[model samples]
Target chain A: MPYTDNTFFLYYNKSVLTETDVASLDGILSKCSAGKQFAYPMADGWYSSAFYFGKGLGFEVTYNDHLAETSIDCDFDNATGEAVTQAMWSYVKDSRFKADANDSKIAAGFNDGSIVAAVTGIWNRTTIQNYLGENFAAAKLPTYTLYKGTADEEQTQLVSFAGYKLMGVNNYSKNKTDAMDFAEFYCSRENQIKHFESRGFVPTDVEARADERVQADVCAKAITEQLKHSKTQKSVPSTLWIPLEGLGNAMITGAQSGSFDLKTQLKACVAAIEKTTN
Target chain B: MGKKRERIKPNVFKRLIFAFKDGSYATRLSFLVMGFGQIARGQLAKGFSYFLFQVLFALYMIFFGGRYVGHLFSGNLGSRLSGERWNESLQIFEKVSGDNSFLILLYGVVSLVLFCVFLTVWAMNVFGSYENDARLERGQELSTFRADLRSLINEKFYIPLLLPPFLGLLVFTVMPLIFMVLIAFTNYDYAHMPPGKLFDWVGFKNFQAMFSLADGAGFALVFLRVLVWTFVWAFFATFTNYFLGLVIAMLIHKKGIKLKALWRTLFVVAIAVPQFVTLLLMQKILDGDGILNKILSTNILWLADQRYFSLLPRTMIILVNIWIGVPYTLLMCSGILLNVPTDYYEAARIDGASAPQIFFKITLPYMMHITAPYLITQFVGNINNFNVIWLLTGGGPVDNVYYGGGSQAQSTDLLVTWLYRLTTDQNPKYNVASVIGIVIFVISAALSLITFNRASATKSEDAFQ
Candidate 1:
């Protein structure tokens, strides 16, 4: 379930973040500096939810396709959630990383060479590649250890929302036989291999992934590694998206501004979710 | 010269009474069935056409229109559930399509409009029939169909010309507005999106909640704060551009100003470029690591950053709005200034008055007099200004200083912009948004009424005109 045809992975400029540093979130965060750093859009709800989605919380989501209803269960204010989140939050006070809500700001930071590495999806692959040239490399998002700088040594890995582009035959098609034939032909292992070779799409067909060229491709290899840890995201109703974002954003903004303590902010976020769901 | 055309208009109720009393047998028949009077008076072609409409309308009502009116009262349940029945012989299930609520509502509204049109045509037929019978009784020659057609170009031009546009506006514009305004009194929020769920009227609950500060949500608190900023923004946006633009226009219009065309074009060039691009570019330029930040070596969160530590974004957006607005004001004020008489300025200047004195006495009074109406509209426009705040900062760097009520609106949000966020954001609180819409409409409407009344109050002072 990696539609972007591939998963988001760690894309780093080889000059700054080496293979060792790229393996862990804290390792990379500890090494970076002003005008040369890592940027993860943690203030964004979609991306920041990863902190809660680690093996500790095990967030669950369900959707009623018939009724267009969506239900999300995330206990991000729990002890594990706070620990993981606070670990991500530790980077914000550092001026070099420039953590904020706007995703473009991070992309721009990378474009201007102020960002040496970023946690981003495949949409930015070409841009990052062009920027880094031979220095371009991608890896599955690093396994993070909670509070790397402090005494707490709780280990966790980043989890992400992953999706697939599914194709189906219409029951009422005029040429049902022909349509079935074409659908099969399009998604066949041979064609999937061809797609991976040309379009860089990670094929759904298992046999297509066995191809030598696909195995050698850096982008595909990184994606394969990343997808193993991703959640098969439900088609969530858009109705929950903005409020959830606002809730998360309010928490971050409150904590940053000293308006609300972390515990109070966490309690309010859950309360908000409960209010909306009811 | 533009007097009301009372002579052409048929009196709403009196015309009906007079027509029935004076009408001939043919005229009375035409009232029941269109074109009958004209046919009985030897106009066979037009009479058959009128009768055809009567037949078609009757058939439509029987076959289709009746169902729409019926469904309007029916449960209006979106869709009957689709089902599949297993067929053992074929080893497959047969599928059935579900009902659609959208279609029912659409057809219901359309039919209602068509019925209204039918009534209008019925009235027209009665009026025409009575007029013809009256003319015949007066010993006046009855005009043929061709004469009736010719008169449309001469006297009855407004009927044919205005009818289509008026109907178009009613169907597209007025209907949507009425639909949205009605939604303000309903619980059509995220949980009650139509088709899947039914929403019933909740009366003034949405408005009540918005106006009340009792709820911990603080919707009223946010509303007042955003509203205050909206007015403050409008005041600053309007006057800054208006006065500064006037000064710039006067400087360029001055006698000693050289290369006048070049200076005007330089300012006009900003406006010629599309605004979204400029606002977006401005957003990037003012960002923390942006060029401006790099040059100044100061980490100013121009967009308030993630926290509202700085009121920089609010001030920046207003400043950019001023920059974007000045050119338009310059163009408009230049035209107004050109019409101001040189004699007034000369008279003030010859009286031993300095440059500042002449401007204060003669220039300011004349320009303000001509531009007062313009100022009101400009103020309204600023009140509704959505682009600058939206595109530049998106009413952001979220802060506890502003009221949220589950919205992401920041310190910079205008009421209109905040309403936009409420409606279009992921979990749309459409009812609250609609209430906000009505509030904005009331504000605009009240201001417009006051302006129009003031204008009429001084109508006799037409010396300026």
Candidate 2:
């Protein structure tokens, strides 16, 4: 975490929209969902955390996000949470938003040019790069509005979970001194730069960041901007994953069906989350 | 007539006692300290190896194993806490409490097993020394170490042959099964996850919670619903496949049925393509945005809508199960149906019986008589069927009973899937899962045992003969 950054950023085609248009959640959803290709893995529980956190449910979602989750203090039934869900109700019925949770499915959507933009992380960089080539660009996740018209427009930024891949030397290793030396060398600026050259890894070392290649990288700029809005993931219980996904997707489905009352359904989702966490 | 001889087998304890008393001093010494008699008989290599094993066992008991055996019932399941104290000498806080209950339990079981193996080795030493002394007393030449090695391949061949596979099964399968059964009595839920927290034996609390209607989670309530659906699913899955498959089999294998190979091959293609693929493809075809909706000119949330309390989803899983299951039964029924003799039908016709009467009285009974065990297995298979419900609907269209606010349990969920969810869900309930597993085992085992007994009982009737 001190060196590395891995968080979900908004990636879109330069051909479809401008920097100004992609700044807000409403703009992206309204413009893309109507006719043009836009998609996100809403059904995926991992991605669903973004919406809940964006809605300002329970507590402030922190950087140590996984460890931060104790029990469900869900407020999806409350005014603010309902307000966000109500905003989401508008986009839920759009054909552009597939009832799919799989990241691979999203990748396929991008590859086929059916999806003009998506919300994902650095792991998907290569796939999108190969698909969209020069047209591919990335930015921080779009902000959402809690108030309709109280002020002109005060936007609440969408936050995503951030994590890091780290290396450590084992205490019991026979080659402990050597292992420590290698670990240090592995994380060195020169080697980190080498990694960036070969594997396109954004380096953690400050010296490596000053490199011209990193300075020119498009994905790196987007991630750097996104880091401001990102939270460190805590080691939370796995129990919340499904219910979170379910709550988000259920709202999406409810929006489409219009049969299940949104508030009642949101209440049930909250109740399920509460019961599970308890 | 030769009488079947029944040898009076000596009780194990009595045999040990007899071996002790009748044995020479060296044999007695070897019982206490292994290979003493073998050393006396000049089988020095064998003697040394046996002695080495004894020393290792003694060392193990003294240093590591004895502690674990002692801790098993000591009522001190260590807390998963690292207590700290200020150390004046080092001028820093030092950790004190390092005891972990989970590791202790694991090590204890392993030690118990090792302790049993040591006892078995001790018994073998006593028996071997006793035999060696007996041979000496009878004035027979002592077997050389080479001769002992030769006898392992010839007379004791089965020991080497069976030991490897037996040990593999005992370690992997039997140990894990015993561990699960032990887990049923513990309170190892998400709240008490190890090695972060400690959980201890709570006796029958987990069992009581399963059946108690007063509990908060309504696990008992939903469990009953899931169990009922499991049985209903199993019954329909098995019988529909059986009857429909039989009809298909009878039709394809029926006399004067033309293009028989063509019809059979068409059905066999379902078998050739893996069921999981077929089921997933079916999912895509049946879903609202799927090909079926495209062709049918109707948008139906076939897998995701529960309008009538899961009447739709429940019916959907059963019907799909029958479709996937029938081809297997059809192939089997065709094979066995051929073996049903033509004589019963011929004789029934001679008695002026109606076509339906002959078909029911002869063909049906005969088929059931032969396929009863298969039917039982299929029935049990359906009870634990995870794939059909999972792939098709994922036990979805989330029902009301699942949540606290009077929601539905996903109507198509079999007990296995529900049990799977209980364990794999964010707040896993392992103890409850274990209890459910035991219950499922009891149900399936009981059914299989009954059907098997019945099958064997009627085997002597010679109805077909």
Which prediction has the highest lDDT against the true structure?
2
Number of the top-ranking candidate, with TM-score as the measure: 1
lDDT by residue for model 1 (A197-249), tens? 66667776766777788788778788888888786576443433443454455
Query: Per-residue lDDT of B24-137 in model 1, one digit per residue for the tens?
Result: 788878777788887888766666777787788889988988786686656443446456677576554545555544455556667777788787877777777776676766
Model 2 lDDT tens row, A70-183: 454556678777776665554455665554435675687678776777888877888888898889888888886666666634577887887766777654356656776777
Clashing pairs in 1: none
* TM-score, cand. 2 vs. native: 0.75
Provide the lowest-lDDT 10-residue window in model 1 chain B.
B399-408
Q: Distance from true position, residue B349, model 1, in Å?
A: 3.9
Model 1 residue A263 lDDT? 62
